[model samples]
Target chain A: MAKNKTFEEKMKELEEKVTLLESGEVGLEESIGIITRAAAIIKELEKELDDTEGKLKLLDLKTDEITPLSEDEA
Target chain B: METYSVSQITKKISCLISADTTLSGVAIEGEVSNCTLHSSGHLYFSLKDEKAKINCIMFSRDVRNIDFLPEAGMHIIAYGRVMLYEKTSTCQLQATVLISSGMGILHEKYNRLLKQLEAQGYFDKEVKKPLPTYIKKVAVITSPTGAVIHDIINTIRRRNPTVQIILCPAAVQGSAASGELAERIARINRHNLADVIILARGGGSLEELWPFNEKELADAVYASTLPVISAVGHETDFTISDFVADVRAATPTAAAELVSFPLEHYLAHLSAQRLRIAQATTLRIEAYRQRLKVLKRPAALTQMLAKNITGHRSNLTTLRKQLAKTAETMLIMHRMQLANLQIRLEANDVSSTLAKGYALVKIKDKLLQNKEQAALHEPIDVIFDTFRLKAEIVEIKGETYGEKQNI
Candidate 1:
């Protein structure tokens, strides 16, 4: 799972899956699969959202490189 | 000395003044007097510095460049050349630029650029891009040493810790600030480093915040591929960057709030969705379970069948009684009819008549109704109630012509 996907994208996917499941057309196997995938995405999104470390950084305009900004920098 | 006419003298003086580079490009600071705009769209005025005065003429084309209207007695700076008016026979400064000093000059330049960019459709509402609903990485272009960056970072850190703030250090003021700001914004676009760019600076006077009003920075904000949020100065202060950006924030901290989402809100929304999904699916399955439960109850069906059987059995009993009653009525009716027929047959029966004491007379085997049916010597037979008598005719009696009788 590359974390490159946006939280919005994952949330949208979860919403669509939930709507389909709620339609009641999903069979036992399909329901299990959707639930599993939706749960995984939700968990991943929650973990990323809760993360507070490694937040601020300074961009070197000359070199165009990124370096983490310490607390004092902020 | 050559003796010359007035027109020739004035032409020679104008030529001499125009030929001097210093006089042609001179700037004079003084008080304005006798200022009037002619119908032909030229301004006629005089600039005075107490000791002396000089006539000035500003053409309409150059007059339109200044932001404010010049009034008499106003102190200002005029830039142009000294030229001799041939018709008036007077030397006048052909002032191409006239503006008040300090903020007045910058205001004029800002207004001129604002009009130019507005005509080019840079600040068009339709051209503005929508800010992304979710901004993950925000590039804040401001001076690194300023408190503005710290305020933005700290505000975003408090509001949404998940959002990553990338500070793009750039000069916020001075002559080189606008160029540096434009360069940094271009670099962010080139690398696609962030989801959105925020050009922010703390509040300052119009002169101190002039870099944000620069056309180069305005153009940079407009040309960005990513959406831009301009947070320059306080709420009351507006800059050209604000007009060109996709969103305008009143302050740097406000910019942070605009681009970041609160984690608590997301967590709450996620929980609500999870609850709703589980509830919806459970409700559906529960409905199906109720239907199946109703179907599984056979006792109601069995009771209905029993009720139907009891009704049919009572109906059969009533029908059997009706059939037996009909058959008995028919048997009695037939017996009465047979008895009536027996009486009719008994009325014509000879044996029944014999039982009534009547005799039947016959001549041999023939029955005799009268003596005329008998021959003279024929044998006659008589039948009584219980026996038959056989005899021959010895005599004939009752042979009178009036009546023939068998006695």
Candidate 2:
């Protein structure tokens, strides 16, 4: 469920939930609920970062073919 | 002397040179020697007649104003000012204008064309397009053979590894470079392949760098829908393309930096944000654990209940002790009162009175409590503490006499 949320929304929700849990006024069940939700958000954020991790590439202007760009070739 | 930084001392020396009128714009007549035309289109040379030599730099912009090239051993009067160049901390001449005899016509033509273009609003700031904030791809138009393309590519890849670089090769300088550059720019725009365009070339002499100053390239740059960044020469060089483009970078590498986002910054920020969330959550959980340990109770409901119960348990203990003590005291008080009543009952006992040798009078087995109950001469018996005797009614002195009776 949290994976469907945008990065910004997930981050905002994670912050709010963390703050609520940190306030030390939550009930045991609700603390557990916040922990569960926060875990999901952190997982989603990690996945998003993993998805963004990509190698450099070069796109040929003439043929429009893409290829991985090595350091020496670049 | 007061303590000053290197920059501060250089500023002081520069101020002294500019404030004096003699150093203002004096033309020095000398034979030019050691003339090295730097790739940036600026001439680095020394002007020496016979006695002394002074270094001079005619910047690329002023190079366009000059009629002839400055070579070693040329007799000329260099028109410039002498000032402390802060970067090198040396006094040198910044030559703005150089005039040679018999050839002053080309600079006039260039100036004339520049003024005409300016009048036509080709260099208008209002016409300049703004670059995209998040450029996904960059269309670079330059000669593909040299280090300029490699520099641009390397700079972009270093900043953002995943950004698309669409290399649109065009001749950077020649008789035909201007037309080719304009055509490539229009083609790149037509393909709609990139967010921004970088029109670039390595530094060269003013004549070699003249392709970027042509009107066709300027027109193509001014009419581009996407933003254009012109990187024509080194830091001192400026061309007509530089004015018409939205942004002018000093070098090809700098143009690449302008278009590509720095992935390091975002990645660092992302890592820091993740760390903050993790640390904050960990701290909160640890706080709960510590709270549980200190209070020896659950956080929400049982914590308060346990507190109340402990308080009430102590109070109940104290009340129990107080109640037991009060009950014991009341019991002692009642026992003392009972003992007093028992003593009073024993003191008024008839047997004890009899034990003191007083007799009880009885007739026909009825004991007379007072003399009014007795028949005077009935066969009567008298009882003492431990003895009994038979008697007759000889005398009744107390009954006839006035002894009071509670009858």
Candidate 3:
């Protein structure tokens, strides 16, 4: 299991990495490393968003008593 | 008419006066009349009763010892020897001790003046103007050659050299000095050159300092729009001008010090304020520099763009997966429903019923739905998949029974 990064730390690292890349002063080698780190941060952020969406869906399912009709079936 | 020398006649008159003089100390009680405090500080008055009156005199030294003031119509006890005034050819009481009968005369005058001014609201703190902390230009209404002016100027120069002194030279004593002082005060106020006015005079006898106690000078000081500092006489001495002025200083030097600020202290305070501002500005700039360093990092840019792209791709993939899953679930459910419907349709099909070896019979044109509907002699037609038959039921034989069939 991946250790979850706090929301604040993830946001800060993401912001810093983006600023570094936009400056365009880093060497190509350094750029690749930074980009890889940025990709990993992006994946983490996506996982977080997915987890939040899943939680929201579960909440909706628990709250709603009426079953939703599929379009084709309707 | 004896042949007497000039010295002899004087000696004889002095001897006779001494013999008739009341040598013993006597206490005479009467109201004071024609009270006159001479320039020499001697008090001369008339002690009078309803029936008779006698001349009285108090030496300067004895008058000084008296606690209460002596004025006309004030009842007082006089203790002195009766002597003959050879120059005036009259007899008078040479008093060495005097005391008030009960109330003090000066106290009455003070209380009366207080009431009059209080009614006029002259003593109201609200109406009194605040003295200027730094009297840049001060008008001095005092004798130019007196020590009062010199003391004030020296004190002011010592405290603040920048303060300008305007001298309105006036007489500070004598009968005419009160009018002159009042005029000079009005003149200084008319010029409007000074922020504050100082009325000062050196210490002197009460009669000599009476000019400052005049009502005209007091009113002028009260009416002044500019604030006034009255410094007349010693600390123990007080006059009407002290009551009317905005502030009363005990001495001339004190009045000057009251209006002057120390330049070195003020400069130090200003320098401290400037240093505080400079330090605050430097701190603010350093904070901004730190924030700029934080914002200049290289990793922030790449992270932002990558996050956007990843978010879009992830959302697209999720939607695609959700669509596929939904489509698969719908397909499975439709297949199940189709199979169930097909079974129901086949069970209701007439050909399938005939294939199950069940025939439908009808009597005449009516199809037989029940055996009771067919009469025993009625002609019936049997329906099979390929052919039909007509038959008559001679006897129903109690309706044929078999295992119940499901369609």
- Identify the candidate with maximal lDDT: 1
Q: After superposition, how far is residue B230 of candidate 1 from its true place, in Å?
A: 0.4
Full candidate order by lDDT, most accurate first: 1, 2, 3
- Candidate 1 per-residue lDDT, tens place, A1-74, comes to 64677777888888998888888888857887887787788888889887878888888856889988888874
Q: Which candidate tops TM-score?
A: 1
**Candidate 1 structure quality by residue, lDDT tens digits, B34-118:** 8898998888899898799999999999988887666666678999988878888788899988767645777888899889999
TM-score quality measure for candidate 3: 0.50
RMSD of each: 17.9, 21.1, 29.7
By summed lDDT, the worst window of 10 consecutive residues in model 3 chain B runs over: B398-407
The segments of candidate 1 whose C-alpha lies over 4 angstroms from its true place after superposition are: A1-3, B1-100, B300-407
lDDT of 2 at B255: 94
- Per-prediction TM-score, please? 0.59, 0.44, 0.50
Give the alpha-carbon lDDT of every model.
0.86, 0.77, 0.72
Give the deviation of candidate 1 from the true structure as CA RMSD. Answer: 17.9
**Each candidate's interface RMSD, rounded to one decimal?**
1.6, 5.3, 36.6
Residues B304-404, candidate 2, lDDT per residue (tens digit)? 67758978899999999999999999999999999999988976797889988888888889876677766666778898878999988766555443446
Residue-wise lDDT of candidate 3 within B1-407, one digit each (tens)?
A: 66987666666766676676455467899988889999999988999989999998889989899986777766888998876676666778889998786355544665677678768877677877997643456777888575777787677767766556666667898789989888767766765757788899989756567788777787888888889999999999887788888999999989988876665654454345334434544555576688787678767666657758878898999999999999999999999999999988875797888877778787878878875786878888898877888888887644445634432
- Candidate 3: what lDDT? 0.72
